[model samples]
Target: MKSERERQLMEQAYAEIEKYQDLVHRDPYRLRYHLMPPVGLMNDPNGLIDWNGTYHVFYQWMPFRTGHGAKFWGHYTSPDLVHWQAEPIALAPSEWYDQNGCYSGSAIDDDGKLVLFYTGNVKDDQGNRQTYQCMAVSEDGIHFTKKGVVINLPDGYTAHFRDPKVWRKDGLWYMIIGAQSKSGDGKAVLFRSSDLCHWEHLGPIAGGNSKWLGPFGYMWECPDLFPLDGQDVLIVCPQGLQPDGMRYQNVYQSGYFVGRLDYGRAEFVHGPFEELDRGFEFYAPQTMLDRNGRRILIGWMGVPDQNEDRQPTVGHRWVHALTLPRELRLVDGKLRQTPVKELKQLRKQQVAYPNAVVANELRSWPGVEGDAIELRLDRIQLLGSMMEIHFRHAARLIYNSDEGVLTLERKSFVNGLTETRQCRLPRLRSLHVFLDTSSIELFVNDGEETFTARFFPYPDDRTMFFGAHGHLQMDIEKWEL
Candidate 1:
């Protein structure tokens, strides 16, 4: 039964939505083709699953305001990824187990019912934190029945344990949870269950101060474990990583490890963690296998504790959004992400400039710019020492072929200064860019590397400038999306 408190919280959230949704929608910086909250702050993509030909996406939402607080699970359903419909709120923090918040988790289809396993967050008067691994079931995938707590605090761990990612393997159910050890080291542990209720601890599978990893981070949040191709991939967000040049530059980092998971030993022998995105925004990504046998992943377009108060959309009563759904693949032992093909359905008014050439000067193409557009540059060649593309004078993509480095610079929302993110690449090739009203996603060299950022440019400044120090050649295509 849904608790009365849960029902009351849900009603309050709906009231917030009904009161401020229109006001939020009037913001010019609102996204054109992405999932955003109705009227408040949103973080972490949670409970991602594809069930019965419909895709369900749940996210962490703070409905009363544009700041993080007691979170509710906001729901959205999509027949095709290009179109999304907002569903009723999924889970609320009404029950005692989850009175504080309903945090991140995963979903699975079991016995013709949709099963959701998520973390219940709680805090006491002295601000002591408590956590529980809880479950819920829905026959129609709409209304849900909470199953309360299934797993309590395990021995030798703090209340920081949360974000359960579960899967079925070899006729048994297995789960990997993001946690922090009692010693304050980050960990991803394993557990097993015959039924969905009772769980048996299987010890830490992979974490800091274990095996080759030493003193990695203070906490690990939002861990996902799955098999791709012939190897297992573990994706996690680790906090307390100091900056190592261009890496670990954000407050937290989300990356992955590819290795083998030994079920009997409950150990994961993996490789070094590689940053999933090299941009200012992107955290707590979740993936689900679609009907096409593709691994589709989406991430929160904003990071925690990163210029949240400075966001322009917050004044309108909503903040943060989700990145485009990208299909994940393992190519040459590294992850490759490209916008899912279904997004092409949003393409309209195709415009192409074949062999657009520039030399020793900056210029603009006749019809190659818009605030919301899909720009594709094919067979790109850096005939000069450098090539730069400036969008609306707010963000710039610069490639320094001499240094073999690509850099993204955007005007800071807080200080009005130019901020840059750089990653070393051997050479330059093609560029696929998605320019939304207030964001840009750069997929370079056929998803070889990707950069996602949120920028607030003047609505009228849709001009794009291409500069080549010496010479450049490429075929460009623009589609208003």
Candidate 2:
């Protein structure tokens, strides 16, 4: 049975769809194969926790329009991370407290029940922002019950207090919420809650030291902290950072720092800032510890700075997706990301090409036309640093070993929009690149690093290309996603 709030939000969403049905929708910014909606605008991934033997993923969903409005918690579950089952709307902004929207938050297991803690966004007559931290409980792992505001915005904190992520340590509950400093700097606040209702501020964790942290914008959204291999890692998506050469190109981005948490002192000390994923579109990432004690992370594939109204898929009906969950490990002071091994279930026929194929010019491969294909290149020799692997036309991903760069360029779509992102990798040998019709996941050097992105292309542009400035030899294998 649908709740009154759910029904109202559905009606409003449908009405908005009808109102904007005629307009040309924009293409989603995420790459193909990532878990994007068939249509609509998507943002921060929320409620990304394993409960009741199923992995539940909820996101900031705006169904009827192409932008953020009257947000609802869209639900999807997967026995494994590869195959996801889309469920109904979980939470709606039907109540007065959260009428404006139900913003981003996280999930936890209270005993055996699934508990969701989220932000209740409200606006007054003058359109001022009033945010409240609310709670909800789910029994069947599908439907949710709204439990009114559990924690209100304390004094000295601005309306930016949102995206609460909770965890248990030493039988005490701890939460990290993204917020802005009184000086208008982006920060994340830690709170201690014994019962999930009353929260006591633990003060700032890692955003105060400007020398090491830089001026990290005004607010850090979706802050996730976890223990990775004897080190505590803090992942934060901060806004208002100036682009330093190739870094922080996206309007907002996600990154992390290896640090130590001094719970007694109510402070966290960390090293310099480093990006979580060096990709074109990854933001508002959330992390949780599974039963196996592994810290798995997932992120929203779209950024708030990019406009999705111009994407072609909006005309068809969906916008963003979640990046494949990655197992994060801190190795020698560096964070290593590898796609969860459980994703192997998604691999059907394993096509192996052992012999190195040397090509002086561009070449094509047969049987690689499907919307999903996994390419594994063993010992790829990029004779010239300037080379590209083209997929589905208009989209070319280049790897420049000399410059330690990997770039994915998409043109001829979205009114000819082009974007490039690069990370420092001394030399590239083995490359595992996953290509879905609308998404791309690049695992460089056996997941020592990864770059996940989403893109949209016309149906006729489905072609693959391997271009080299000089002679190149690579062992390639393509798999159906």
lDDT by candidate, in order shown: 0.92, 0.78
Q: What tens-digit string does per-residue lDDT give for candidate 1 at 164-268?
A: 999899999998899999999999989999898999999888999999588899999999998998899999999999999889888899999999999999999
Candidate 1: C-alpha RMSD after superposition: 0.8
TM-score of 1: 0.99
Best by lDDT: 1
The TM-score, computed over Cα atoms with residue i paired to residue i, of candidate 2 is 0.92
| CA error at residue 356 for candidate 1, angstroms | 0.8
Residue 56: error of model 2 in Å?
Answer: 0.6
Instruction: Give the worst 10-residue stretch by lDDT in candidate 1.
Output: 1-10
Error of model 2, residue 141, in angstroms:
1.7
Candidate 1, residue 360: the lDDT equals: 92
